[model samples]
Target: MSWLALFFLGTFTGLLAGIFGLGGGFLLVPLLSALGIPVAEAAGTSLIAVWFSAIAGSSLNWLKDKFDGGKSFQIAFLGIPAAQLGVVVSNLFPDRLLKLIFAVLLLGMIYLMNLRQQLSEQETDIKLAPSPPTPGATGRKFYWWRYASIGAVSGFMSGLFGIGGGLIMVPLQLGFLAETLESAVANSLGAMVAIAASGLIGHAWRSEVLWIPGLCLGAGSIFGAPLGSYILPRLPNGLVTTAFRLLLLILSIYMVRASWASGWV
Candidate 1:
């Protein structure tokens, strides 16, 4: 792809990433593959792009006091190592298989997001209704396992698929941690910085990255990430959730067809 084309692609990807706390890799890898880049190479390139976008978005989150430092660190601690292992495992798969895997993952994510939305709605309704106060059942207990599990799973997917892991992280935070959507998004972006960096190192060591393309994409993301962050807080919670699910639905359909195309493979 031309530098200009890559630049524009990165900008669009970054915009969405900023809004949704994604690393943009979920979209980037498949889109690059569609543009005729090899799947493995696309995945590797996406890590670089994700790294930049995460840094950009995370920085803004921090500046805006939207970050949860302790929680983010807990996720990154396990995520960093898990990401390296993921890269090793990815080398065992052929591009055709990887494409199919990615498609399936997208479909699964759509279901998960939908489930999260429903759960969020239920939680909202429960909060709105009056309830008897419980004396000793404070919901503020910290759970290390929760963060560790989130990190490991998200990190592994990041390495395997070249995504920022926000797809997994945000939903899990909301479901298990009772984080608001905006807070979950901010925390997800924060954790992605280290996770994406670790994945990028592994991909680079394998010589799978296209540096020029990745750099151009990264540069564009730096410009777009802030704009996305700005818009997220202004949007309604339901609208944001709906948009996320819809986007995933569309992408999943496109990925299924692309992965099944024998000629493409």
Candidate 2:
């Protein structure tokens, strides 16, 4: 029954991953911890599901020629090392503290999602009332340092929280790299392939992963990811963004309660 539960959870998370380029760790770690798994083990185990789902989703994007290979590669290369560092840092925190931290991250995500929705609305208005192209708009420079910073921070989050880092990467790409939502999602998934793999290695070294449960979750994600990819371009961005933000809010509340219950507050 536990295996079945994890599989279903993975399927749902995979769907979110496909659409948002998330690794699903944000949802997974908290839920797993709620289900009585240790926070560290939950975080580590979530990475296995993240890795497989990322591969599934990214492959679909690649096949459709929707991927941003160059940016993905840049993020992945730097993210690999940073992920290791995040794992080391994660081991220093206690479980209750980690739950609080994850809850805070979720609140942050809600704020970013609100910002992204506003940006999307602005873009729609611009399209409706076309303006003269701003000078140099098409010639915006690609800054390597910006990409490096995005990769490093996202990678660290992935390792520390068992998230796919898409939660960070997509917003950063939109704000800093001027990528469209779809493009940022694709690139985030591409980068996650490497980031999750690196995180899994570090977690395994510490014997933190729950292999059987993680595998069951990953197997389910394989099916869910393709479905999410198929739905992405067809859905309304505003609706999805609003719905995702709500889901994050609910999860954040749950995590906060869990942390408080841990007698640490």
Per-model TM-score versus the true fold = 0.85, 0.87
Point to the candidate with the largest TM-score. Answer: 2
* Candidate 1 ranges with C-alpha deviation above 4 Å: 19-21, 126-142, 229-246, 262-265
The all-Cα superposition gives candidate 1 an RMSD in Å to the true structure of 3.3
- The residue-by-residue lDDT of candidate 2 on 1-265, one tens digit each, is 4889878878888888667645678888887888887777887899999999788778878999998788888888779889999888889988788888899999998887677666656656656885723325444345666777799998998888888887678877777676677787888889899999999999899999999999988987887777786898899987777778888889989888988898874
In model 2, where do residues sit more than 4 Å from their true spots? 16-21, 124-142, 228-242
Error of 1 at 150 (Å): 0.8
The 10-residue segment of model 1 with minimum total lDDT is 132-141
Candidate 2 collision pairs: none
In the order shown, what is each candidate's alpha-carbon RMSD? 3.3, 3.0
lDDT of 2 at 144: 63
What TM value does model 2 have?
Answer: 0.87
